[model samples]
Target: MPGGLRHLGEGTAAALARELKEELGLDTDQLPEPPVLRWVQDQTTTRPGSTEPFERLHLIHTLNVPDSIRSRIATTEQDANDTTQVVWVPLAQAAALHLYPAIGSVLTTPAGTSIGPVELPPMVDGTYRWR
Candidate 1:
């Protein structure tokens, strides 16, 4: 689930490796190349302190980590003002949660399926199940 904006002159695989290294403390050799892209989300939102709309492109990739690091991954990550919690829930359980892109169950789709352009309305209830 480690993700970040792609750096200039870097491909997606390299960017993914960078994010995984920075966020999960994993080295490139520990990770396989060419992650499987699961989805591409076209997200639009209003950032804090701004009324104008902001657009972002999300590339969702599925990576399988060895058991060595799967359960040992840090659950909490601290930054300036945000804390990211990592958890591995069953796909069905995760689908039931109110997730952005609403990628319910598609995560279990067979390989080679290109799920893309996932869009949805803003949640007025301010409720989100982020993992």
Candidate 2:
């Protein structure tokens, strides 16, 4: 997924569109509406190899992509500043990977577990720590 905070006065959908184009070279005009906010985690973190502390708000959205677009996406092309690697992991082996917000419960929850939104736990740290 694209990263970076929203620009001044920009809405979520617009920021996502711009970030998609700039970071992943994806076109959002042909895609569906803005994604549903699946989870939000607030964290106090520190940069790698640095002692500075900062607050980070993580927003995970669930966007359904059509098979046509999904098929065209052969691989995730990263931008110069993006360090994330996108790969497909089988649901059975998903736990082996390092994932943030610890989505194990979310993955294991049965379908129709609830009708409305699902909110995950938040992270707080006394000192600087990077995930």
Candidate 3:
């Protein structure tokens, strides 16, 4: 999504939960324990359509989808604005796409300030980690 931080009020798990419920109408209880939370920083100074200074610390939450629920889930407008787009791409293809570098070093060091030319992690089974 373009303005994920904005959509997530105060940037808390509960807020995210509320957002998900309002946006996608997905029940958080259907999700598994301890959703994957990744911390990222948007170091870029110049962003499109904004005069306010930017702060990093973008947290991305990855929720597991049950096979049954996956089939029922659909992207809403909120999801689109909060996320770029929801696509069903294979892990191999997704891995080949250029993703933000900060996503790469999450398991290790914080990735340097850069975007693009980075491969995303693979999706295993039906669960995929979000960055």
TM-score of each: 0.69, 0.69, 0.53
Best by lDDT: 1
Error of 2 at 108 (Å): 4.6
Give lDDT per model, in order: 0.63, 0.62, 0.49
Q: For model 1, where is the 10-residue window of minimal lDDT? A: 122-131
Error of 1 at 20 (Å): 1.4
User: How would you encode candidate 1's per-residue C-alpha lDDT over 55-126 as one tens digit per residue?
Assistant: 667777777677786766666653213767777787767777656654564655666554553433432224
Candidate 3, residue 48: the lDDT equals 44
lDDT, candidate 1, at 102: 47
Q: What tens-digit string does per-residue lDDT give for candidate 3 at 2-116?
A: 1234452365666766666656666777876545554444343434466664444455555666767766655544555555444555444544654443343343333343342
In model 2, where is the ten-residue run with the lowest total lDDT? 122-131
Stretches of model 2 off by over 4 angstroms after superposition: 81-85, 101-105, 108-116, 125-131
